[model samples]
Target: IIQGYGLTESSGSVASTVGPEESKAYGSVGKLASHLQAKIVDPSTGEALGPGQRGELWVRGPLVMKGYVGDDKATAETVDSEGWLKTGDLCYFNEDGFLYIVDRLKELIKYKGYQVPPAELEHILQSHPEIADAAVIGYPDEDAGQLPMAFIVRQPGSNLTRQQVIDYVAKHVAPYKKVRRVAFVNAIPKSPAGKILRRELVQQALSMGASKL
Candidate 1:
């Protein structure tokens, strides 16, 4: 219900969507808390953005970890020049204080020059009538450097093919956003925190290559 974003070092409690009736907005994560302060910084300029805008999410609070115990380089890279905690999540807060997760800052693929967000593609794939669940990831390609590939789980007793999935994405997303490859899977791998293990899928798409249904 109440979804908030934070890093593992922060104890993963900086943001959470919690409340009995909060489940209505299934995709919108909830806002910050008494001890938490969040701001959006433009990845390129490091300028802060207002509500309803998207950017890299930053957090500052006592709950945030100073850095890794021994990984000073990793800690320095993540904490940045300021004391803010880099959450590495692309998201926005609505005017009413609801947070909406867009995608991961690191997972975005570059096509020619455009940023292709895998989470956006995955959301579209999951919306298909026949799809039970879906995961989208970027794979290396010579032309564009990287492209999205969707792995889907279909509804019980339903039949869907690679081409059908491809056509479905084509119908819904922009040409650049359309998934270049698709693989039907028994289920989409997820973590205990409900996060998809996209890195694994990216590896699979590389070996499996893009194929039409």
Candidate 2:
């Protein structure tokens, strides 16, 4: 099935692809809908990015919700003065006009100034023969800013060492993207839709004294 993208603030879909021609492009969420206007902007600088540059996505249109109920502060933060809603999603568009969602801006690991996508490392961790599932999170670190931490669920009866997991990720990714800490768990927290409950893991890490890392 072709994947489409939308949000509650937009009130409905802001982009979708239809027809056989559009469906064949793997990983694309399709093109932007005609009525809405969209732009990509650097999260830190707020400078608008051109097509093919990965950045935060912002959209504005009649369908976009005016503001969040009862919370003017949140409304102000989310919807800008120009009526654009900051989707807080990292994305990029190809030359063919197909949009691809990368990951959430809030979930990205800021390691020493480089932005590392946790999903990329998590994919490689899950590919290991002794791993069943995995999740990646950024643990607070004074020297490096934030270090990537891996929470894994091993294959039943499999015993994996911390160094083994860390080495596997280091081999696949750059130095900035390597998994620095490891935690083995039975299962990963998830929503009903099977989305990783990242916030819960963040809380877990903090409670377990992640600040020292």
Candidate 3:
């Protein structure tokens, strides 16, 4: 895929991934272009994280934007004095050095101090035998802070049921990563570019919280 990088103050996505082969690397956003410099930083302390470690993605270089149009505080929070843009994205680099997007920094769920990634559950759901598509979102919880919930679209004419989907993911993933709730819909709502609309799915999960199936 052709790749691009950008900053919040300058603009979104300064560099973009292009070409057929580059776009197929679903694990990562893509390689950096000549004009950009990207770094993965430790979210906990703002330290630069090494390859293969989960952290926030940061960028600088030519493709970087100028600065805030009006809001200095907002600009300051995102861009440091040295001009490095603090991207709120959560991701890691593969062994081959391609970037792998995991989740947003704020969307990461803390389950009793253990971080639970919603995207991982979605991947597991998509792998299920009867699921055509799936979306997982974090829901507020009294104790865990946030819990993993799933929404799925079954394969056409497939006989799988809600409990079956839940059991399937539960059996394969760690308990903390298991789908606590499941909802089967006619289709998985998505953006025009094909990203799952997590906000809507989270609302649907809340509405179906009391239902067994």
Reference-based lDDT, each prediction: 0.80, 0.91, 0.76
lDDT of 3 by residue, 1-213 (tens): 355545454455644557887777775667665566778998788898888899988878764665777988878888788778877888777676577778877777777777888778888888977889888777778888777777788899898877788788888888888777677789888999798788887777777766543
132, model 2: CA deviation in Å? 1.5
Each model's RMSD to truth, in Å?
2.6, 2.2, 3.1
Per TM-score, the best of the predicted structures is 2
State the weakest 10-residue window (summed lDDT) of model 2.
204-213
Estimate the lDDT of model 1: 0.80
Error at 195, model 3, angstroms: 2.4
- TM-score of model 1 vs. true structure: 0.84
Deviation from truth (RMSD, Å), model 1: 2.6
- lDDT by residue (155-207, candidate 2, tens digit) is 98898988999998989988889999988888999999999998898888888
Residue 25, candidate 2: alpha-carbon lDDT: 83
- In model 1, the runs with Cα more than 4 Å from the true position are 18-26, 191-194, 209-213
What ranking emerges by TM-score with the best candidate at the front?
2, 1, 3
Worst 10 residues of 3 by lDDT: 1-10
- Winner of 2 and 3 under lDDT: 2
lDDT of 3 at 112: 70
